[model samples]
Structure formats: structure tokens, C-alpha cells
Target: MLVDDAVALVPSIPGRRALLGLAGAPAAGKSTLARRLVAGVNDRLGAGTAAYVPMDGFHLSNAQLDRLRLRDRKGAPETFDVDGYVALLGRLRSERTRPVYAPDFDRRLDEPVAAGLVVPAGTALVVTEGNYLADDGPGWGQVRDLLDELWYVETPRRLRERRLLRRHVRGGRTEAEARAFIASSERLNARRVELTRPFCTRVVSPRDP
Candidate 1:
């Protein structure tokens, strides 16, 4: 769907603070699309009308992952604080009388920084992007339930993989290390995310923007 069309869909949802979720596999352009949607909404509606909240912020710290022995599967579904994410979403929905702060993931630091984004008290829409929003595993189902709508961002496998490799290399991985990580971790996560496509309200291409 066209991003302008997607932007129009946000305010139409019946709520004081509607949450719009953009879910997809890694490097499928969920983050890009979410930023566009939020910017488009705010430009069309008004400043402070929209905000962005990213799910990457919920990723477990490397130390925590090491303790759990899931460091190797860092991007997997089990590597996030799902319950915390769900609780934050609940607050973003009900507590509209004050600004709500949300965390953000820093790729360079490989850690989640608290209160990196803020949703104003009277904001009309919150655009959140992530890989596992549509996943039904454990605490993930509540994420889908909280959002008024969840749209899957679809990109060709080749393009997605290329982007992932570039992202990893930019984050300090060698080309060989990037490819290995993709093969061992990202590929499996992407496949798992694909299974949740049926749960999305819409499937949108990154090219649509």
C-alpha cells in the first residue's frame, strides 16, 4: 500500500491514542516505513500528533543474553523483554494524560537505552515497528492485541538479506562474520517472522513509500 494511504488509515482508527504496528523480518524495512508513517502523519495532521516507539528497545542486554546462553541467537524471539514491551504498550494506550517514555536500541552499543523516545500526552497516534509484533509466542501475543492495527512490511528475500549484511558490516562485523550471523541467526528469525504474516491486518511493501 502507498505510505500516504497508510498514513490516512492511522487517524481513522477509533481511539484517543491509536497504536499502529509495523511488523516484519529484519532488514525488511519496518523501521524505515514506521518513520515515514509517523512523519507523514505529523506533517499532515500536526506536530505532536504522532510519535515513534521501536520494539528493538526491548532487546535483552548482551550480559543478560550471555547469562541465558542465548547470546548467539541474539535476534531470536526469545532474546527480548516481551513482558516489558507489553506493559509499556498498555501504558501508552491508557495513560494519555502525560508523556510516555520508551526505550530505543543502539546498534553501535548493542544495548537498549531507556527513555529514548517520548509520546506526548495528547498525541493521536503511535507508530511502532519491530520484527515479532505479530508472533504469538508467549508474551508476544499481547503486543498484537494492544495495537489497533498491525501491518507487515514485505521485501524481497534478496533485498532483505543484502540490507542485513550491509547493516551488520556497518555495525563492525567482518563480511564473513556478517554472512555467518545471517545464516545462523537472522535467516531463522526471518522465517519465523514470515509465519506471522497471516496475523497482520495488511501486507505493505517498503517500495510503496
Candidate 2:
């Protein structure tokens, strides 16, 4: 189904901001889909009517990872600052008149860029995508409650793996390293992410109808 179609269904709250979340496994294309939904809604509504805030911005810095001995598995849920992300989302919903800044993850540097994205005061919808948005753990369950709607982007395993391989290679991994990562960390994380599917408001596959 077209992402634009999904955007059409987002009901506007009278005074509070509406939040739409897209959750999926690594390389499942959640971010790309989230952007499309945001653009589609804005196109039909009005410019500056929607904004995109990604959870990747909450990724722990390499320094922090090194200190925590989690450098080897940087993308794992434990590697992120969930509390910080949750707080930001809370602020976005409560502080409607002020600007809320969100961080963006830089793949080239494998780090987060501070205040890379801004959700303006009048934004009607905020589209946030990430692997753990629907996670049911203590620090994560709040995410599901904050979102007005959550769509889980599901991709075929093979296709998802291929996209991940390419992304890893582009991010400076060799073919062998990429394959090893997929076989180990990424695969494990993907499995965990899929378990949160039942918590989503809807499942959005490439073949969504």
C-alpha cells in the first residue's frame, strides 16, 4: 500500500501533537517509509505540517560504548539512551508552542549528530521510526503509549539482509565483516525487533494492501 494512504488516516488531535511511529528490524526500511509518510502528509496538508524525528539519534557515542564495553554491538537496544529518547518524545507532546530538537544518526561516522532535526511548534504530526519503538521492556513500553499510531515495516528476510549488507559495506565494513555482522549481531537484533510486531497498531509490509 502507498505510505500516503496511511498518512491520510492519521487523525488530528485538537491541541496535542500527533505522533506516528514506524518500527522494524534493521534494514527493514522503516526510516525511508517514515520519511515518505511525513512527506505525503505534508504534501496533502501543508508544508511544515509534519516533521521527522528518528530514534537513532539517541545512539550512544563511541566513547560511551567503549567505556561500557559495548562497542562490538553498537546497534543493540542496550546501546541506546532510551531514557533520553523517551524524554524527548514527552517534550514534543507537551511543549507544543516551543521547538523540540532531536538528534540524527550519522552512518558515515557511526555516531549521533546533536540537534540534527527540529520539530517545530505547529507541526500536526511527528513521524518517528526505529527498531525498538514497539519494544515492551520497561524503558521502551512508554514509546508505544506516546505514539498516536505505530506501523511495523516488514520486509522479506533475504531482501532485508541484502539491503543491510549494502548499508554495512557503505558504512566501511568489508564483505566478510558485513556478512559476519549479519550472521551475529544484526540477526539477533532483528529477531528481537520482530517480537515487538504484535504491539504495533498495524503491520506495514512492502506488499501492504
Candidate 3:
């Protein structure tokens, strides 16, 4: 669906606050679309009408991943604090009288920064984007039930891989290293994300904007 169409539907949802989730494989433009949707909503409605909450913030710390021996598989669903993400979504839904803070992941620091994003009291909609939101595994199963709508962001594999390559290179990896990482890690995660496409409320392409 077109993003403007998606943004227009937010206010009509039957709730004081609505959570719109964007789920997709890495580099599929979920974050980019989430930001655009939030901006579109605020421009059409008003500032503070919508907020963005990213699931990347719930990524396990490098130290934690090292301890768990999952450092090499950073983007995997198992590498995140799924329960923490679930709890934050609950607060964003129920805590309408107070501001809610959520974490954000810094690709430069390669760490999750605490309380990097906030949802103000009375926000009418929250746009959250993540890879595993549609996954039905363990703690991830709770995420779908929390979101009012979950749209899977779809991008051509070639485009996604190209973006991922540039992203990894920008993060300081050599081309060969970036390709290796994608083959060993991101590709596997992308396949896992693909498996959950049938669970999404809709499929949205970044090109739809």
C-alpha cells in the first residue's frame, strides 16, 4: 500500500493511541518508512500526534552478546531482548498519562543506547519498525498481539543486499568483510524474517511512497 494511505488510516483507528508496526528484513527500509510515516502523521495531524519506537534499541549489549556467545549472530532474533521490547510496547499502549522512553541502537557505537526515543503523553499513534515483529517465536509472539497493525516492508533482494553492503561498509567493514557478514548473518536473519510475511496485516514496499 502507499505510505500516505497508511498514514491516513492511523487517526481512524479505534483508540486514543495506536501502535503501527513495520516489519521487514534488514535493509528493507523499515526504519526509513517508519520515520516517514511518523513525519507524515505529525504533519497531517500535529506535532506529538505520532512518535517512533524502534525495536533495534532492544538489541542485546555487546558484552551480553559476548557472554552468550551470540556476537557473530547479532541480528538474529535470539540476539535481542525480546521480552524487554514487549514490555515497552505494553507501556506505550497503556501509559497514556505519562511520557514513555525507549532505547535506540547506534550503528556507530554498535550498542543500544538507553532511552533514546520517547513517546509523549497523549500521542495518538506510535510507529515502530523491526525485523522480528511478525515472528511467532517465544517472546516475539507477544509483539504481534500488541501492535494494532503490522505491515511487512518488502524490497527486492538485490536492492536490499546493495543497501546492506553500503551500510556495513559505512560502519567500517571492508567490502569482503561486509559480504561475508551478510552471507553468514544478515542473509540468515532475512530468511527468517521472510517466513513471517504471511502474518503481517499488509505488505508495503519502500517504493510505495
Candidate 4:
């Protein structure tokens, strides 16, 4: 599961204004899977036919979080600019418009980079990957109505932890810190994330997919 594509989800993408959602808990392979799906779909559909706009980029800026007094709570659902994510989805779903610009998350900076992304015209599909794409909050409510399909991915809890720990260490955390962070922040979010499972069109567990 650590090194594989969800081929079941690959065939779901279509050529035209299709909005596909990829949802999963932190470090459960959603980003990796989404990337694979995008590549698979693009290869199948040909050039300029597929694009990716992730929900993570819609996260509030560190400065904005400081202003809101929520700096310590980064990555929690409220830490994101939910309305901004919904707005971007709206733009993609619109008809014959100019190429839509999207924000992207910078792992090195731990911040979102705005207008550093573009969905070229004739791009038939937009794949949005995130932890809470299927959340039922008012901010998240706009998604299901907007997207053509939603998929949820699940990794075994232990595997998820191991992958998350590796990511943290690779991104500059000490092994101890990575383990601690997974035990604390990641697990906390995982429980909250389970609340989103029922909302998806399909649930893709590692073995099943």
C-alpha cells in the first residue's frame, strides 16, 4: 500500500469539467494516490486534459492564523480557509472561462503559495485531494454538490502511522519528534477524520483497492 496506485479510482475520471474528490486521513496516501490517479488519467486522456488543485493550498496563511489567534491549531479543520477552497471549486465548474489560477502548499515553507498554479483551458478534469473533502460543515457542504464524484482512502492505522512518521522525519523532524507528533496531532486528527467516511461515494481500503 505504501507504493501502489488505486487503479479502481483511476478509471473514474472522465474527459470534461469533471470534479473528482480524494479524501483520507493524514499520511494515509491520499496525496500520493491522487497524484498517481492524475498521471494515469492524463496519460489515458492525452495532453492538457487533466489538472490537480488540492484543498491544502486553501489553508490560511501563518500570518492570518496568528491574526486569528489559531497558530497552535494549524492543520485542524478550522485552520483552513474553507470558503476559499469552495470558491476555487466553483471557478473550475464554471463554463468556458479563462484558465483558473490555484494556490499550492509549500512543504518547505509550511505555507500556501498563491497564484503559483494554473488549470489550462481544455483541461477536462480537476482532481482535488485533501483530508476533509467530505466533511459536512457548511464550508465543506459545497463540495459534494459541486464534485462529480468523491472517494475516500483508508490505510491500516499502523501503516498510516509509519508513513506519517517517515514523512515528518523526511521533512526535518527528529525521529522522536516524528513519533511524538504522530501519536499526538495525527492521531487526534485521524479520529476527527473518520467522521467524513460516510459522506464519500466510495471507501477504498488498502486491500480492497
Candidate 5:
């Protein structure tokens, strides 16, 4: 798996902590890949060696989304707290010794839980993944510069869509509702994400070694 290959490269990085960003479209498995990479690195090194921070944690609250009239486009970039997300990454890179708390998104509640995760002091690697990391937009472009390396997870469109449908269903949407969402806004976001692949340090496909 690429997780093993990625873990093999971490020791060569010259830093007390290294940040790795993984970008991919929804359901392309950015979170899954990141979790695997973090686990693999920690297993080889030691516990607390790596932490996973997801950009989904920066999603705006439902009230804020309603105020902005972005409720229907909840997964879109405009629906996230882009500035806050950037600030968190900046803090992660510059601050050491003190514990850095990160938020986590709860699919069941469809909201972000505050201080849901902590990156302990001296943790050697931080793996952050999201759809927008590879994007070249104003706030997003800065994210690339902070990372030691950025990887993109690419999967077949049909397979990705299937995964998304199942995810939505599990998240409380019916199969029809999931398909409709995918056919509508989600697919548009996926297309926009695909445009950023060229900006990534490397691309990882399931077929790759």
C-alpha cells in the first residue's frame, strides 16, 4: 500500500514535525488514505508520532450556513471557514511544545465538534486531508506551501460516486436523495476538485504500487 511507501519517506524529512496534505474529491477516500498513512507511520515509529487533521472540521455551523444562504451547498468551499482552517494549519506548523487542538466533523450531527482532536507536543508528522488542499484559490494556495508534501487520491468516477452514495445513505439521506445530491451539486464540486490535481506533489491511485 502507498501508506507503507509514504511511511518509508518520513524519516528523511528534516524537522521535528512534518505536515503532509492529502487532497481528493469527495468519496475518493482522502480521509481513509490519511488514516492509514498516519497509522502506518505511528506503528513503525511510536504512538503519538502522527496525527490526522481533517479540513471538514472547518465547515461552518448550520446556523451560519443558513445566514449565508449556503445551506443547500453545504459541502462547497464557500460553506467552510477557510480563514480559520488556514490559521489552524499555521499554528500547527509554527507552534511546538504546547498541545494543538483540532476540530472534527461529525457526520451524524452534520456539524463540527470543537477540540475533537489533539496533536501532542513532539509529534513527528501531521497528516491533513481535504478536497481543497490542492486548490489554487487565495486561502487554499497557502495550504500547499505549509505542507512537506501533498498527495492526491484519485479513483474511478463510477467507484467514487458509488462510495459517495453509500456515505450519504449512512449519513441519513435516502438512496434517492443521495443520488440526487450527487447528480446535482456534489458532482460539480468533484469536477472543480479534479482541476487541482496538477497542483499536488504526487497523485495516488488505487492501481498504483
Candidate 6:
């Protein structure tokens, strides 16, 4: 989805609770767009006014998932530590002092590292980007309650799948294996995300112009 629309939508926020959310499927470039938006916002507003916190950090540890025998569904909603993520969002929204610690997901290891992230106070806007940020479930609604507005990044399913497949291949999966995983795993999640698209304040479609 278009970055400028997402950016423009952020300022209309009701005020004080200056949090924005970006939601989409995996490899939809949600994180990349979040970075660009932060840079653009900070470029105009000066430093430290904008920050990004992602939901991927709340993934349950591989070990923990292994214990639960849910490791195969890593990207599924139930696979994440949803409660912990909600708590962190609450803290960030309130601008917690004394460094609120958060888990950080290490892609190389495919696990979450505890207390590896700290969000200090004075961050005027917390732009969170994640696949489940717009989910309609009770766990995800907690994030919605803390945000002033939310936007969904809209991309063609074919293009999204192409990008995700390439990303999986680059991340070490064989081409055939990557395609199969995306078809079965990523496709399911994308469909779920599409269902929740209506919850977004706006839908953004990026153009090359």
C-alpha cells in the first residue's frame, strides 16, 4: 500500500494518543514501509518524535513452541505470545518510563530473545507494523484500543506471494520447498489478513509514480 496515504492518515489522529498501526501479510513490506514513514515523519518533525515497534517481536520462543508442539505453525496467531504483545503495546501507549523491556525476534535463529528491546519515554508516536495488528480477535483488539488510527497495506495476492516466495528462498529454503510452504502456510495467513482488512482506518495501495 501507498506510504503517503499511511503518513497522511497518521496526523488526523485525535491527539495525545499518537499511535499509528500498519497491518498486512508477511513480506508485504510492512516493516520497510514503517521505516520509510518514520523517516518521513521525523524528517519533518525533528528527531525522537517517531519510533516503530513491531509485533513480530512477540513471537513465542521456538523452544516454547516446541514444547507446545506448535512450532510448525510459527506464523499463526495462536503461535505468538499474544498476551505479552498486548501488554507491551499498553506500556508503549502510556509511554512507560525506566525503559520498558520487550522481546526481539531474531530471524537468523527464528526465536525470540527476552528483554532485548527497550522503549524509552518521550516517543510521541509509536508506529507499529505487523501482520496481526489489524486482527479482529480479542488479543489484537488490545492493540487497537491503544492506537489512534490504523492502516492496512493493500497489495495484490500474486505479487505478495511472489515476494514471499523469493524471501523464503533467500532465507535458505529451496525453491520447491519455499513455493510449497507459501502455498500452504503463507496463503492461509494472507487470507485471514484479507478478512480483517475492513478494520483498518484506510487501505493504502502503493504506486510507482
RMSD to the hidden true structure, all candidates: 1.7, 1.7, 1.7, 3.8, 1.9, 3.0
lDDT by residue (tens digit), candidate 1, 1-209: 45566566555444467888999999999888888887777788888888889999999999999999998899898999999999999998877788899999999998999898888888878888899999999989889889989999999999999999999999989999999999999999999999999999999987766
lDDT of 4 by residue, 60-127 (tens): 99999999997656677888988888888988876435788999999878789999789986777777
Higher lDDT: candidate 2 or 6? 2
Give lDDT per model, in order. 0.88, 0.87, 0.90, 0.77, 0.85, 0.75
Name the runs in model 3 displaced over 4 angstroms. 1-4, 8-15
Worst 10 residues of 1 by lDDT: 6-15
My TM-score estimates for the predictions, one after another, are: 0.95, 0.94, 0.95, 0.86, 0.93, 0.87
Q: Among these predicted structures, which one has the highest lDDT?
A: 3
Worst 10 residues of 3 by lDDT: 6-15
Instruction: TM-score winner between 3 and 5, please give it.
Output: 3
**What is residue 184's positional error in candidate 1, in angstroms?**
0.5
**TM-score head-to-head 4 vs 6, winner:** 6
Which segments of model 2 are wrong by more than 4 Å?
1-14, 206-209
lDDT of candidate 6 over 1-209, digit per residue (tens): 24344345444333343678888887777777777877776776667667777888888887888999986677888888789888888777665344567777777777778877665565566778888987877687677777778878888888888898887787778999888888777888888888888888877753310
Error of 1 at 93 (Å): 1.0
Worst window of 10 by summed lDDT in candidate 2: 1-10
Worst 10-residue lDDT window for candidate 4 reads 2-11
Q: Write the per-residue lDDT of candidate 3 for residues 1-209, one digit (tens) a residue.
A: 45566566565544467889999999999989888888877887788888989999999999999999998899999999999999999988878788999999999998999989889887888989999999999899999999889999999999999999999999989999999999999999999999999999989877665
lDDT for residue 19 in candidate 4, whole number 0-100: 76
lDDT of 1 at 129: 89
Ranking by lDDT: 3, 1, 2, 5, 4, 6
Question: Residue 3 error for model 3, in Å?
Answer: 4.3
Clashing residue pairs in candidate 1 are none
